[model samples]
Target: MLYYEDLTTGRRFQTASHTLSEDEIIAFASQFDPQPFHTDPQAAKTSVFDGLAASGWHTSSLTMRLITASELKDVANGLIGMGIRDMRWPRPTRAGDTLRAEVEVLGQKPSTSQPGFGVVQLRWTTLNQHDDIAMQLETSIWVARRPVTTTEPA
Candidate 1:
C-alpha cells in the first residue's frame, strides 16, 4: 500500500479510460441531477450543449471511480478526501466519450493533529478521448504515513 512518503511533488500518473454511453449518462442524471439536457437526448439538442450531456457531478463521480479503481488503488486505507477545491467543468461530457484522468501530486504535509497521517494535495484533470478537458479539480487527501517497524535483537 502506498503511504504519504510514497508521494512527492511533481509525481504523475494516469488512469484507464472509461467510455460513457448515452444510457449511462441518462440513467445517472435521471437519478441525481434530473435535467433535460442530461436525461433526454432530443430535448438536449436544443439546450446549450446542443446534445445530450453528462452532469458535472457524473463526470466527477466517474473520475473518482477511475482514480480509486486504477493507479491509486494501492493507497493505504483509501483515498480519503479532506476537501475539494477549484473544481470546474470546462466542457460538457458527451455520450460515447471515452474519459481518462491525469493525476499529479502537488504537495504533502504532515498533519499537526495526527501523528501518523499527512495530507496530500493533488490535481485531477479529466479529459475525453478527443483530449478535451471535461473536468478538473484540486483536492486534498488524507494518507497514512509509513509505519515504523522495529526489528528484534538477533
Candidate 2:
C-alpha cells in the first residue's frame, strides 16, 4: 500500500497499453460529447479533424482507466482530485490509436489543518503509440498519511 512516505518529488509510474476502438469512441461521444468529429466518421471527414477523433473528455477518462489498470490503486491514498491545470490536447486521438499514461510526482506537503493527510501535486502525460503526447495536465490530490501517535506512560 502507498503511504505518504512513498511519495517523493520524482516518483513516477507508467501505465500499460490501451487501444481505442471505433465503437467505444462513438458510444462514449454519442452519450456525452456528441460532436460530429467524435461520433460520426463521415461527418468528421468533412470537419477540421479530417477523421473521427475522441473527445477531450473521453481521452481524459481513458487515461484514468489506464491509471487504474496500472496497479496504482494500492498506492493511491484516497485521492481527492482537486482539479486540473494547464490542460492541453495537443494531438487528435483517433480510433485504433493505442495510448498510455505516465505520472510523475511534482511536489507534496502535509496538510497543516488535516492530520493523516497530505496534498500531492502531480503531472500526468498521455502519449499515443507514436510517442506523441496527446494530452497533458497537472493535478492535485489529497493522500492519506501515517499520523504521528503519542504513547502514554506505562
Candidate 3:
C-alpha cells in the first residue's frame, strides 16, 4: 500500500468509466431523492433541468464507486474519508452519460494527534462523456504514513 507521502500535489488518477442508464437513474433517485427531474423522465422535461437528470447524490455515489475501483482505493486504503467540503454539481448528469472521475492530490499533512497516519486533501471531479463536470468536491482522507527513520552514526 502506498503511504501518505506517496500522494503529492498535482498527482492525478483516472478511474474507469461507468455508463448511467435512464432506468438506473430512475431507480436510484426513486429510493434516495425521488424528485421528478430524477425519477420521472417525462416530468423532468418541465423541470428546471429541462429533461431527466440524475440526483446529485447518485452522481457522487457513482464517483465514489469509480474511485474504489481505481488505484486511489489501493493507495488511500479504501478511501478513509474524514470530511468533505465545497461539494457542487455544476452540471446535471443525464441518462446514457458515461461518467468517469479524475482525482488529484491537493496537499497532505501528517496527523498531529495520530502519528501513524496523515490527512490528504483531494479534489474529485466527475465528468461526463462530453467532458462536462457532473460533480466536484474536496475531501479529506486518512492515509497510512510510513514511519520516519533516522540513523545514528555507526
Candidate 4:
C-alpha cells in the first residue's frame, strides 16, 4: 500500500472503461434517482436529455468501481469520504456510452492530531466515449500513513 509520503501533487491515475447499458441505467435510477431522463426513453426525449440517461449517482458508482479495479487499490489508505465539493454534471451519459474516470491528486497534508493519518484532496473527472467530461468533483479523504518503526522514528 502506498503511504502518504509516497503520494505527490499532480499524480494521476486512469481507470478502465465501463459501458452503460439501458437496463442498468433504468434499474439504478428506479431504485435511487427515479428521474425521467434516467428511467424511461420516452420520458427522457421530452424531458431535456433527448434520450435515456444514466443517473449521476450511477455514474459515481461506476467511477468508484473503476478506481477499485485499478492500481489505486494498492495505494488507497482506507477511504474516509469527507463528502464531495463542487460536483457538476456538464453533460448527460446515455446508454452504450463508455465512461472512464481519471483521478488527480491535488494536495496532501499530514494530520496534525493523528500520528498515522493524513488528508488528501483529489479531483475526479468522468468522461464519456467521446472524451467529453460528464461529471467532475473534488473530494477529501483521510488516509493512513506508513507507520514509523522505532529505529526510523529516531
The clash numbers for all candidates, in the given order, read: 0, 0, 0, 0
Q: Write the per-residue lDDT of candidate 4 for residues 126-148, one digit (tens) a residue.
A: 99989999889999888888887
Candidate 4 colliding pairs, count: 0
lDDT, residue 25, candidate 4: 98
**Model 4 clashing residue pairs (backbone):** none
- Please state every model's RMSD to the true fold in angstroms: 0.9, 1.8, 2.1, 2.2
Candidate 3 lDDT over residue span 1-154, tens digit each = 6789899889999999999999999999999999999998889999999999999999999999999889876774657899999999998999899999999999999989988899999999999999999999999999998767999999
Give the lowest summed-lDDT range of ten residues in model 3: 71-80
TM-score, candidate number 4: 0.93
User: Which candidate achieves the best lDDT against the true structure?
Assistant: 1
Q: In candidate 2, which residue ranges exceed 4 Å CA deviation?
A: 147-154
Q: Taking the tens digit of each residue's C-alpha lDDT, what string does model 1 give over 27-76? A: 99999999999999999999999999999999999999999888799989
Model 2 sits at a Cα RMSD from the real structure of: 1.8
Q: Give lDDT tens digits, candidate 2, residues 92-114.
A: 99999999999999999998998
Which candidate model has the greater TM-score, 1 or 4? 1
Could you say which candidate leads in TM-score? 1
CA lDDT, candidate 1, residue 12 = 94
Each candidate: what lDDT? 0.95, 0.89, 0.93, 0.87
